[model samples]
Target: MTGVVSRAKGAPVELVEIVVPDPGPGEVVVDVAACGVCHTDLHYREGGINDEFPFLLGHEAAGTVAAVGEGVSTHAVGDRVVLNWRAVCGRCRACRRGEPQYCFATHNASRPMTLADGTPLSPALGIGAFAAKTLVAAGQATIIDTDALGGWWDPAVAGLLGCGVMAGLGAAVNTAPVRRGDTVAVIGCGGVGCAAIAGAVLAGARRVVAVDVDAGKLAWAQRLGASHTVDSSRLDEDGVVAAVQALTDGVGADVVIDAVGRPETWRQAFYARDLAGTVVLVGVPTPEMQLSVPLLDVFGRGGALKSSWYGDCLPERDFPALLELHTRGRLPLDAFVTERIALEEVEAAFATMARGDVLRSVVVLDGSGAGATS
Candidate 1:
């Protein structure tokens, strides 16, 4: 198998030929069909997550089952699936209490993937899909109905449903639950933010405000159904709050989502909502940065200030349901895909990701030229 390996922090991932072991008990080996370049993968490359070196850098993926480990009866060879990081451990406290998304002991492949020299590599988020093949716990490869789910969310767009899109869209629909007639705002116009805007529209928000530093992304947000847009780069931290609030008649939005994950954007989201509204933080913030808000505000604010983990998604329930919705033409999942590339070009894709050149540059693996190499 050829996998993209990040040898160290801030280092380029090298395309190295490696060996993948047969699936152990309760594991599955997937011949990755496609993967997407995500900011989280970039974060891993930059050592933003942890000191775990030699990280496998791709996770947003969809593929077909090449082999299945013993005792895994739910899937077999030829099952088309999308990979998920939130593989639940049934024995965890969260799972015992019926909140499996918060599973404390999510499992990955018990085996380790190694470099050509036999050095172990940590798979990014328990998924390493930027290659010809990858190993995962059977639970992570959730089945998606390719025949049923199509449209803006065609079978090809299923990659987004694995992570970024799931987190963004789930933030609005699952976590925030933007009700019909609710006024909403999303800070950050990236893939997740745009998905948030789309989810808000699907939830029937009366007015959707899209905020971003880039005018181009904001314009795309408008096309995704945001009723208004704000250029956050042109506005100060407080100015952003006021801008979002101004659109909602000074009451502020009913739900404000900070998708940028910076402290400043988070602060804006805190003050940009109505007094009793919700503030959903869906962005990935760095650990060195700490949040310090006025203690009075936490008390004065009556509504929830929530942080979503994978948009509180239950893959079995949400992935298929969202896929069906996409097939029905209700959700525009296809628009999220801006370009398609190959596995060898993942490094270039990362550079493009850093530049914000496209909404999502997917690495198509199912016989799209890249498959020949696979």
Candidate 2:
């Protein structure tokens, strides 16, 4: 099957033939329908994630189970499912403590997807779905009951819950655990930040403030549910804080989320919330990014300073519930899909995402192409 492969760091990804081995024990093969072009995939292509060359990119995906390996009972052929990277191992210490979301040992397919020439390829975040079909551990496949959802589900939109969308939503719904009638502020109104805004609304936050330097992204945030927006492009750190406070009636938000993951935005999130309010950092940062904040501020501010990994989500628990919300016309998951293109357009999609022209550029394989979408 043909899949997108980043053969070298900082090089353009190529559509090349790949070898998908038969599913090993406890593994499953999914016929991918749609996969989102995520920032993480670009990070891998640029060697920001690691020096793992020849990565099978694309993880945010939804598909139908094509086959199941021996001893796999949880998933069966033809099961409509969303693929998740974190396939929690039941024996992990976190799982034993009833915190499977933090499972120390996540499961991936034991066998590797390789190049046609027989070189093993490291899949981005494990369940690479840029191709027509990909292999994964059975646990990574979370079955979605579209039948129960009144058959109102779209693979293009549903696949988003597999990663970035889930992370942002989970950051507010789970990490900050936004309370009803609480004021919430999210710094960064990109895909993840906008999802955080949507999550805040879903959690019943009284006021949801969207902060971003990009006017287009701020517009996107308002559509998703941000009650107010702060144009941080022309503002300094203090100016941004004051804008948020003014919207909250001179009192800072109860919960502030730093979705930009930069040192500056993080600092803004710290000071933009009420003194005793919670701050959640859901954005990812590089290793060289160091933080410097006043020690007195930490002592004075008396709420949780937390970082959310994948929105602290348990796919098995969160995916289905969020999908149900979408089916019920509550969560506007479809708003996230700006456009859908064929697999060959994956490379161009990255460029579009970089320019902030779209929230998500999805690769829709309609069972046509070198590798079938089914």
Candidate 3:
């Protein structure tokens, strides 16, 4: 199969022929239909994550089950599925306690996907969906309703569930749990942030404030259900907090989500909420960045400052529910899709997404129709 490989740090990924192993025990091979380009892929290209060379990029993906290995009964050939990175082991301590998302013994493919020349390829987050096919544990293959008119979920929408939407929606509905008539604020109007805004609206938040430096994103944020928008242009911590407070009777929001993940935005999320309100950090920050709030503030805050990882999602529970919501038209998952391109166009899609002009650019396979699943 042909896959995107980043042979070296700071180098462009090459579409190289790779040898995908047939599913081993407990694994399955998926014929990928579409994959969405995410910021994490770019981070791998820039060597920000690690020095794992010859990395296979692309994770957020939907595909069809092409084959299953011995002992696998959870899925079969022709079943449509979404691939997830976290495949937890039932024996892990976290899993034993019913917290599989934090499972210490997550499972992955025991065998490696390699270059045709015989070198092993490191798949990004164990997903590496930017390819013709990929191998994953049966558990990683979450079966979803992909029959919205293609081999996979309509590429135009099902593909986003591979990552960003899961992260954003989970952050809001699962982590923050915005209640009816609650005032919510989401910092960073990017894909995840906008999704959070939409989640807030769907969760019954009465006032949803979208914050970002980009005017274009803020405009789209409005469409996604942000009741109000704040352009974080010359605004510091106090300025942003004051603005949010003003929108909510000077008590700030009931829930503040820092989707940007920088220290500054995190601090803003910390202070932009009313006392006892929740703060959810869904952003990805560099390892070197240190959080430096006063210890007294932590006690005074009186509520949780939680970190939402993949929106604390169990794909088995979330993906099917989200697909159902999409099929019902209650969740506008399609609004996150901005463009549709072929596998060869993945590089250009990254550029467009980086500018924040596009929410998500899906790589639609030939048979799949655009945007219908959403």
Error of 1 at 15 (Å): 1.0
* Pairs that clash in candidate 2: none
lDDT of 2 at 19: 90
- By lDDT, the best candidate is 2
Model 2 worst lDDT window (10 residues): 365-374
TM-score per candidate, chains pooled: 0.95, 0.97, 0.96
Residue-wise lDDT of candidate 1 within 88-164, one digit each (tens)? 88898899999887889988899988887888888989998888889999999998655554312233477678999
Q: Kindly list the per-residue Cα lDDT of model 3 for residues 1-374, writing each as its tens digit.
A: 77888898878788889999999999999988888889999899889888978899988888889999999988989888889988989897899998887878777888899999999988988888888799998988998755543322575577677788889998999998889999999999899999899889989999999999899999989999898988889888889988889988789899999999999999999899999999999999999899899999989879888999998889988888887777677888888878777878877887888777798887776556363533
In the range 1-374, model 2's lDDT, one tens digit per residue, is: 89999999888899999999999999999999889999999999999999978999999998899999999989889999999999999897999999999999997999999999999999999988999999999999999887878776578888999999999999999999999999999999889999999999999999999999999999999999999999998999999999998998698999999999999999899988997999999999998999999999999988889999999999989999998898777899989999889989988999999999999998888632223122
Give me the runs in candidate 3 sitting further than 4 Å from their true place.
145-152, 369-374
| CA lDDT of each prediction against the hidden true structure | 0.87, 0.92, 0.86
Candidate 1 TM-score versus the reference:
0.95
Candidate 3 residue pairs that clash: 156-371
Error of 2 at 348 (Å): 0.8
The per-residue C-alpha lDDT of model 3 at residue 65 equals 92
